[model samples]
Target chain A: MVDDAVQRFCQQDLQLREALGAVIFGQPDAVDGATCALLAGGHLLLVGVPGTGKTKLAESLADSTGLSRGRIQFTPDLLPADILGGETLLPGSSGDRVEFRPGPVFTQLLIADEINRGTPRTQSALLEAMQEYSVTISSHRHRLDPLFSVIATRNPIEMEGTYPLPEAQRDRFLLEVQLHSPAPEVLTRIAAATTIETQMTATKVLEPKQIESMRQTVRRVIAADSVIDRAAHWVAATRPEDPTAPEPVRRGLRLGAGARALQALILSGKVEALRNGRTHLDDEDWKKWRHEVIRHRLVYSLEGELDGLGPEEIVSAVDRAVAHQG
Target chain B: MPASDSQISSRSRRRTPTGLRVPRLEPRLRAGRARILRHCSRRGAASGIAIGLPLATIIWLTDHDPGRAAFTAIGVGLLLATVFASRQRRRAATLWPRIWDRIIGSQSLIETILDRQQQPAGNPWLDALRARSAHLPLPSPTALRRHLPAPDPRPSLALTATAMLIGAVLGPFDPIPEVQLNQDSGSTSVAQISSELPTDEQLRSRQQRIRGREDAALALAGRPALEPLARQIRGLSPATTAPQSLLPRDLQAVQAALQRLAAGDPIIPEVALWNPLLALDSRSPMVTSAALPGDGASLALSTDPGNEAVTRSTALADGGSDRPTDLSPTPFDPQLSAAPIDSIQLAGTATDDASDLRLDTSVVTPPGEESAASWDRVRDDPQLAPRWSRVIDLYQLWIRGKEGSGGG
Candidate 1:
């Protein structure tokens, strides 16, 4: 099976993330979240307040992976054509025209910095491309590269002017990695590293297609029945309709993580396990990403901002409530 | 040394999906890039790039001269031809959209069914129909909405070639002429040649021909099977019009949005309203204006906050099954006097696994206002349109689900 070498190759894969950590520190979970997403053959959604090096972390990931990079900086004035693109007819010399042009969304790794900064209209253009891995324009269709992913970084605290990423956009991402401010030591290390023109070379280890196949292999990694059962139970217990859901979830919440939220855990769990060369998923893999998988999916009492009791807290509470079921 | 994060990331080689397949990306990418670059520079390559000619100025320079104009035009034509042919050869350009389009088609089916419910006439019969509609819930304390079986009929088909083309062009490129106009144009002989074009009259004629073809295409596409049905309804007496056709194009837009989201196509907001599903079902004539607000609120219960589980099904331990059924497969409820309908739809063209559930394609809604907002958001996505087009998926799953008196 290709997974064998990939399992062995995961050691190499692990090393790359490690190298990235040397330059960017204190956010092991964020790194793990991104790693898990990459291995699962899905994209990552990074959320945090501004000035947290979210952009830096994504850049480091791209550099470490040696994937060709493209970026779209979301702005309120940004149009759908600015990100997803449309056919732009450039005037040709003999009074003819140049063909249609594509936009920044077409790349091996697309870093959509401050994605929520864009308007909802501009924002939805990207949501579909992320899910379908394709775009339709001017009577034709375009497919994204196998390794194509939009590592969208969002600023949750600065919601005053930004539009929320649609729920469908949230659903499409394999992981929603939140970047906490780097600890003083990590910041110090980053500061020291940036003292110079901070250019480091990552060996060209794998091509986009190769990386894609490796991801498929990672998906094939085994997740034991019990682990799957635990994941399913955890998902069921979060829904307000589920009798087993927590008091907070049932009383205050409007919805719970349906089957897809459960799948995110199971799928990412397998990727997390295999990256460590472990054949079967363990409980820790799910625990590691518990927050990332279900955070945005939770719908708290309409008091989204006021009730401090968001999906993260509910998931943690549900995790506690359902521990015995595991 | 103990393994570290950087150690892992640094060593994480981009490997191929197949065994020992260190799939060569450099060549592939370079080839792709070369194709793009060649397409970008093809005209210049043949026409002999003029080092000093400002790209925009070159046209002015040639247009001013009577004798040199013809030569510039010929060069422009050849350059344009190369660029055009090379662009057409863009591998898999249509792949992603083609795949997504199939998903859109699949999702569009959901809107079709929902569209059936959206009558132009808001009347008592519509209320009776809502009460009668299999998926609509009856106003009750304990029970949830009664679901109908809207089964998916077909699998989607995706062309690989089109996908590659899409992926190749996802990155940004310097627009050849426009950039040259401002900065140093990579103008050599090729720039001059690529710029050559037909006269304005010829261009106008070509545009007219293309528009005509496009109109024909739109006419074919805009025509729905329901249009004839609509025509039949239009002929109905005014008395019956209110009862028979209650839905509007706006409602169809909402339905279309749902199908798009369901099929993993991106939902589009260009429609009349943002929250179509959550939009009030005023067509039910029995729905008195007295309880209008309550109707909107009651419909909100259809979705819930599903945070813990994303996409997994299993057989339960308490002699139960956790698998999500295709919505009341046989109508487990005794209350339903009608035989459970197995309304299998045309299946999606291409999917991850027709049998294996993809959380990306179909949504599992939450059962409250939160569910309503989230459902509306995702349903509006055109990318998810394909699954939504298979409108019956959620209903069918619910219909087939094991019905118990209360939550477990």
Candidate 2:
């Protein structure tokens, strides 16, 4: 009894996963997370060490989805005007006039590489476009493509000459896809494959309209009250001051995920349901992607940092607490 | 392809414009709820048996009726367990749908349908979900039974049965008898007082009476020959001052006096005969009057003359006595008086011979130390006079009273 649109989206989603998996060697979770973010019409933040293929994942996701791609290598000297275009003066045939020049962000899929290297002012420039799917240049609003999504990559090991993404900028992301180091077996395959003259590339598996239609179908996926309640409980358990918060969370976290995190969880869960050919959302759908959708939004306290508590530990504590409550 | 008007109307009729319909899932949910309640009741009953039987046994051990206690305790335990099971069932009612969904592997489709049933707008996805749920296999009754397994009653039943068996074997307890003592007077009864060994006050009163009788006997026996008789009486042991020994001692003293008379001594005056006769009749008021100082001088004068003349003058002098003439020799029977002395000697001989028997019976020991066999021997002894057996019985009662007072 699957809807035709959901069935079609599942078929396209399988091809997209295969296309991303070909180039991204061993990170299946990252591929699924990226696909889920894309299909939900939300931004994704890629976090991993160097040589773990964070940039490659962003690029492969853009290629596999067939969306118009744009790249921005963030640097310390990058300005807000460089990311979200500004007005410039030009000599016209009639008289001297000002013209609005579009930046690279006008594309459907924008890849912000080494996003943390940019200053706070430059990072904030993409926030509105990622959220509202529109850019405001000199009060002249410009709507983005219907399938606009940002796949930003950040190097976790490189702290030098980089500005950490602020809370406001981090919350704009629906999920932070963590790409782990490849296994030894996967590394041997990667070594033999990468040394060849022919480079690995992702072919387009889904059209832009199909992805937009999938996003609409994902939105239409029915989330029952129980699933929504479980998601709400999981997000609420992350806050340090919440009564339902576990001891580890109350001690290790300073700020919990907000309402936006709940929205991202249900929205991503719906996309996950569609990928699994389920017309209705289930608890498993939210539970499967809870860490990715919630880990980045949590802020650790000074004590927690001193105690070496991380976002992964906090999210795991929330998971155990919510499950025990059930 | 386009749908015909009739076909479109049929499709619209099949769909609920408001929300999704799950006709097949509700019955399964109801069955699951029933299974949950049944499981709760079984667990509650097991708990009730585990707690009730021991409580009933405790009540039975305290001398209460076993059947009544068991019935009351088990009834209360069952009532409480029923109430608790009902509460558990009510709390579990909301969880059956979730359990049903899990059992059937619907992946929360039932919950989704339930939630969708409240929504005003219908979605094609929800419609498709309902359609898919209709074809999903319903959970088998065996599966539901497995999901809610019956609580094991064997352990509880075994423990309860053991408790019941113990209660049946032990039966109701008998209450111990309590001893009551009268503390106000420091004594339980008059027989208790008489049967116990004499206290100092009683000893002094007996000694004073003996000394008065000795003085009257010395006044009446006014010859050198009678001095030896008085000395013999004085030589008797002081232990004979106890009331039980008084009768035997007096009899011995009178027998010694008659032996002196039979040894060719001059016949003593009638006043001398009064001492032995009055001693035998010590409870008579005439003996008390005869022992007065004025009667003693008259009795000494009566020893001075001829018998008839002296008896007449004594009767005139003792007219104030209740039985003045009865104390005279005219009323005395010599053979009858002598027969008592012979019987007294025989009784004393029998007592000496039965001393070994007394040791075997332990009748003379403290009543507290005496056993039932000792009391039976005392009662059955052929040689013990009825009067002495009665005295032993009173002695036993006195000892019991002493023990009671000490316990209190």
Candidate 3:
């Protein structure tokens, strides 16, 4: 039974780009990708040059999508207990015994702001809640809500005093959305809106039930075999070659994207197609998803110049190489 | 009917896997798991000599009226062993077909051999090496022996029980044969079975196997036997390393070769074969030529019959007999001719009248029900797959020859 409530609610899921920008502003693509990631039952990564308003976009998308916001400002010192909500026997005022006090990690939207700045030891604490949607602390495993998600962010320019993500950890994100500087016109509107007398707070449009139903609908968006095959081919082409070969492998690219890339590709493609109001994923759907699905996972060579090449550029090259190989 | 988004998967009807599951392995896996659990449970229940012991030792141990206890133990052990073996066999059987399919999936023998990456690593030597070993004489255990050595497989009483008994009795006074029969002597028998050399090719194979393990060779063949066995095969290793142990057959080979040379018959050292073989002529009963295949010392490996024109060779026989050896159809040299491809031919040589193995040429070229298709099915029996796989693997090993060359 298609509940009329869920059916009536997702009309806003159509013009979501505009609704998200009412609060986030200058991050239409990030908000679009994040919203789709939520609908597809996957996670999102918002990586950009610092001060690109990624946090603003995340907050607004959480609002426009009608999800309860759970904020976590990740730091080098943040403990797993603080984020994952471990069992601490806090004594009750009744003078009897203690009880478990869950942490902020229990919410639907877990915003790991500046996620990579935290140490891997601290960052990995969220990995369980990110993937299995669960946390195991002190041997008590608690599976989180099925609608639970993580919108993690990292800045690209800073190299020093930063705990940059290792290759293994970068592979977990569903979409590696790279937020560039907004165009001059968009920035002008952003500047005026921010400095204005009346500030805009996000308005909730989706209920908890609507969010759950939309997740299943997005999953039902059929992915064509050829489009997915092309996606897989590109990821495979990026693996490094052995040194003892007659000639060296042309690039020192580490092993290709993990299973998460396919996951991101399918989810992002579903969102892309649904934005155009199509039922199936197509070539254009993959074309839109290429950067979002692949960027962060494209680990380059040890060469200094190549290391600085944006993940977006490497992923594009990979796509072209795969098409050529095909 | 399409289930709605609100409908829970739990409420949906579950049926036997018509479309419910993947076609292969799922049901098989569940059944295999159940069998394993049952075997483990029996092993847990068994006491005395425990369970899963070898049939031969169990029978031999119980020879001296080993009563209800030994019989019960042997019965339980055999029951468990049969269960364990059938499961192991099934798993091994499943594994072989999968491996064969995998090898078939490979583009060439080179792809089969050096393609250890599971996917392409863009390595050249490994690619080339894999190409060459694909074409060798690989045999099946159906054409060889069936079973391997049956070890003493029973578990012992708890160490706590043994220690308590030892502490009560002044040192210890269990009957010598009764105490250690299943221990050192039973293990000795097991080791002997493993060390038993089936053929000269197998002898070389054993030599090759032990060339890396000196202490193991000494432990296997013993100090008295291994010392000289080690010296004879010093330069004979395919890996170029001599083992420090010996076997009885290897030493006997050296002694026979020395005796033949001293006697001064028409013995040629170039063929690298040394044995006191008494050969009989196909036509005449007197004349003999013991020249065989396998580096001129192993079994008869004939040519493949795919090609019509066989590349043939005929050796001149010069036995120290009054009758001159004559070539019937020769202008100046003997032109031997026959169908190739592992053929069956009658040859009378080194007639060991007491030998147990009845080497019928018929068995070598199996006929009837074992036609090519059925042969594949029979050949894939987990019991026989390793032997066939070995034959192919050895062909690759031969092609690669030395490690200093490729895949460094």
Candidate 4:
């Protein structure tokens, strides 16, 4: 039974999807993955080459969800303090006390553009705020809103001077949605629309309370033991070290997804099931969303790369193998 | 009790009739699995024979007994097919549960129903999953098989059958009968002939003696008393040693005569076949013998072993001839016949190019079934082809000799 809160959240999610579709033109999967990441209250990573509208899509997410948005354009020289904020001395009535000036990470929605352009040290600074939902500057912790979400974008690693995101930083993202160049029809539509100054603004479809409430409703979704078993099996199958790893993983992978991947899979599956007007998780939900949720978390072996095994192929192999498992 | 549409729908939604129930699904799943296993076994048997027969035929071609080699090939093929079939069956059996999981998971009702069976959620919201997947379709094994492609063994079987038939009929595996004509006088019959051919000197001497005697017999044909018999003998002679259609039959008759001669008998069962009386459609006939009733010291004048031509000559001298050849009296050997041939050249005709004649002595026989039955013939029968038996004996000896030389 879909409760009133879940119903409202699903309706709002559909409205947000429609709104993003109007502006994004052809990237329905990317928009849906981002929405799911937002509803699940986890970070999203948008991976694509430049000029694919990854940044515009993130901006649209911020606009469509009615959340206060802030952006950080990561570069090689970016520092931790730049993202987590710094304290400034302010004279009060009684004495001088240090006031924390929050960085761009303080807003309800933060879009870190070209995140891989930042060095690992700079990237690690967002880890605490992303996982703990709070930033600590000089032992003073500043809490973020319950609706806080990070939608990050990165250029293809082959681009010159771009740093690759480490496995740990990549694992923090709930979903890695790949963006592609628009098809001919969508490109034609985009060209036709952009000829004149058409300042297209997305309609705000959800509030902070609604997002938080939807997360609560998603948490209440029932995930059966068998569904959990399949999820665990799938996650374990990614690890090449495990004896039970699927054939592809055994041959191509050096490292597998950890327990965190399983948690994300099950949690995202619950959200997926709830959004589809169901209050219980099924393997279908897990199978459908697993590639996005777990792809970034996987570490393929050098041999796997040399053999031209992509994360999508590896994940699909595991999916097919697990689906055939007793 | 009367109920509203909502209540009726909700009631029906809680347990969709077609949703998988563990109790019911187990047996159906097992049956589905059994069907797959049966299919594998059936496919293994059909394809195994198809593959085995041809493979066995190939094995037979290496100068092996056609019967035994074929059986070995078939046995080996079936063994391999069985192993592969069982492996496939086990694989299908092991994977069925995962297949069931996906099938059950597809139906929200099945998943919900299974969850309720395992652990019932008290919240009505969670219970609603049953209704969400209530209308989801359930699949049957036939439907699944239709969706998934399984290999059709029929085409493979037909191809294999064709291959096996071709292998049996035309492959080198069949026996090529090598008719080594032991024309030497010392070599009495096939059974008495040694495996090795006569040396060149012995062959030359024997050939010369036989040629000289034949010349003398030709000269003696001018005598009025021997003219008819000489004409008959000339008519019986092969027009050429290059085997003609009549040669084998003639050779078989000669072989029967030699077999009887080797047995030290005066009469051969095949004597009736060579009798000129039979060929001439003459009613009057008499058996001839080299030793007349009263002359034991006289040498038999017949060149052909076991023929009663000398007895016929003596009868003509006595002027009595009124009987079928089958009733002809048995002959006697005075040991004065021309020496047996040393080497009866089995020659083929030369082309118009005037090239030296080359003979193809190897006579190919059809492939026999390589099965338990054919192997039994090889093992148990005494009348099987001597060449095949000799080859088998030589193979066994070679194996033994190799083992001995290897110091095993």
**Residue by residue across B42-107, what tens digits does model 2's lDDT show?**
655555556555565556555465678667776767776776666656555566567667777777
On TM-score, the candidate that comes out on top is 2
Single out the weakest 10-residue window by summed lDDT for candidate 1 chain B.
Answer: B308-317
Task: Give model 3's TM-score versus the native structure.
Answer: 0.42
Give candidate 1 regions above 4 Å deviation: A1-3, A90-98, A197-206, A224-226, A303-305, A324-326, B1-408
Q: Which of 1 and 4 is ahead in TM-score?
A: 4
Classified by CAPRI criteria, candidate 2 counts as medium
Error of 3 at A65 (Å): 2.5
lDDT of model number 1: 0.53
DockQ (C-alpha based) per candidate is: 0.01, 0.51, 0.01, 0.20
lDDT: worst 10-residue window of model 2 chain B: B340-349
The lDDT for every candidate, in the order shown, is 0.53, 0.68, 0.52, 0.62
Clashes of each: 166, 0, 8, 13
Best by lDDT: 2
Tens-digit lDDT track of model 3 for A1-326: 22332343256575465777686667767777777777777778888887788888788777776776688887778777778775556566776564456788888888889987788888878778887888887787887888888888888787776797776667777877778888898878888888889877667776778778777666655554545776666555554442221111235355556677877777777766656654445556766777777777766567624546655556666656665664
Candidate 4 docking quality: incorrect, acceptable, medium or high: incorrect
Q: Residues A7-115, candidate 1: write the lDDT tens digits.
A: 5558756776786666556877787788678767677888887767688778877877777788989899999988867776677678867566778888889998998
Please provide, for model 4 over B234-347, each residue's C-alpha lDDT reduced to its tens digit, 9 standing for 90 to 100. Answer: 345422221222222232333333333322222222222233322212111112222122222121122342334434434433543543223222232323212231111112
Q: Rank the candidates by TM-score, best first.
A: 2, 4, 1, 3
